[model samples]
Target: MTASPERQMELTLPMVPDIEIAAARAAGNLAREIGMASASIDEMAHAMIEACINAREHSGSQDRRIYVKITGTSLGEGNSRIDIWITDHGRGFNVTEARSRRQQLGAVHKRGWGLQIIEAHMDEVSITTSDDGTTIHMVKYGKNDD
Candidate 1:
């Protein structure tokens, strides 16, 4: 069955590489506290870090501000899902084009692997872009109900 939406928590941080790790850790911890497995927490954290990095790095400036929002919900009877959204205010690029660029650049170096990694780990992933900014929505499933 399709997952359901629930409460949301939002965070805004300076678009700097140094802060991404911290943000990921905090998010992961929160996820775990809410019933996600350790591995799932790690995976979600990694995905969040990657998404934020892409927003800060390729989106625009090193000083740009990125907004992160997470929502958690109980699925079925014992399952839960968390949705994380990372947004950036910059000139957005096409997801398809971005993948092509990354493929040409290769994943060994600084290629566009964030989306792929996020997709690999998260239960759901969606991207919305406009002149104002771009937002990435990622969903992670947990082990139990609320």
Candidate 2:
């Protein structure tokens, strides 16, 4: 497989539990096609799943949509990076606030671990919230240095 000079794909679908699997598969396929390392792709796929699960479980039940945009770029010589944006159309919350609350709870709940897991795996994680909704931007490092 050859990596495209420009590697990118966009997927938009209903924010439902079942659809997350499709998204994960799509992401993994892209990673392999673009020559991303297996371990990096696996971590990225997991991050995407966690983000989508949050959207499906915590977001409103109806009329909710998730948009996924993935871009793979050659950073330098052989190094590459993958940027993934997962946006959900639902009532927005402050990511920082939610994280703080979860931490302060001092209890371990699987539900609140989604963001933490995503952050831990990805090279960079950013959360943007607005009246429209919330967007989670995650980036993973690829094997190639250029």
Candidate 3:
């Protein structure tokens, strides 16, 4: 409902810890609305939690704000590609550096697994970051889309 659920959606959430729950809820609803399978919906929620957590901890947003946006082609029996954008206005880190750090982490590492979980779940993932903030763009296909 952010933008008619047709072309795109934009939502602003008060930058706060524990906001991931809200995100997961919204994602699950959208997935169901598009007739996505339960398994995929769960995966999307998992990724959303990781990303939202990262945004909360890393995105140095003094005002404490997080943004979620959804966009898709259509929802039905055919196929659809859903795109979600999670952004925060905090100090940004280099994508390459983050990946390298993740690669260097031990299997039992306690932290720094947000992006890793995200990349593992989503069909496509890309990140763009700068001093202004960080934005993670994640894509997933519907039940029959992939």
Where model 3 places Cα greater than 4 Å from the true spot, the runs are: 1-7, 75-77, 102-109, 144-146
Model 1 segments more than 4 A misplaced? 1-7, 61-63, 101-110, 144-146
Kindly list the per-residue Cα lDDT of model 1 for residues 97-130, writing each as its tens digit. 7655445444556767778888888888899987
TM-score of each: 0.82, 0.84, 0.84
lDDT (Cα, tens digit) per residue for candidate 3, span 12-49? 88867678998888877776666677777788889989
By the lDDT metric, which is better: model 1 or model 3?
3
Please report how far candidate 2 places residue 78 from its true position, in Å.
Answer: 2.9
Candidate 2 per-residue C-alpha lDDT over 1-146 given as tens digits, one digit per residue, 9 for 90 to 100: 54444588999878755888888888888777767788898899889999899888776534678888988876555567788898887877768766664554555753577888898789999998876778899988788512
How many residue pairs in model 2 have overlapping backbones? 8
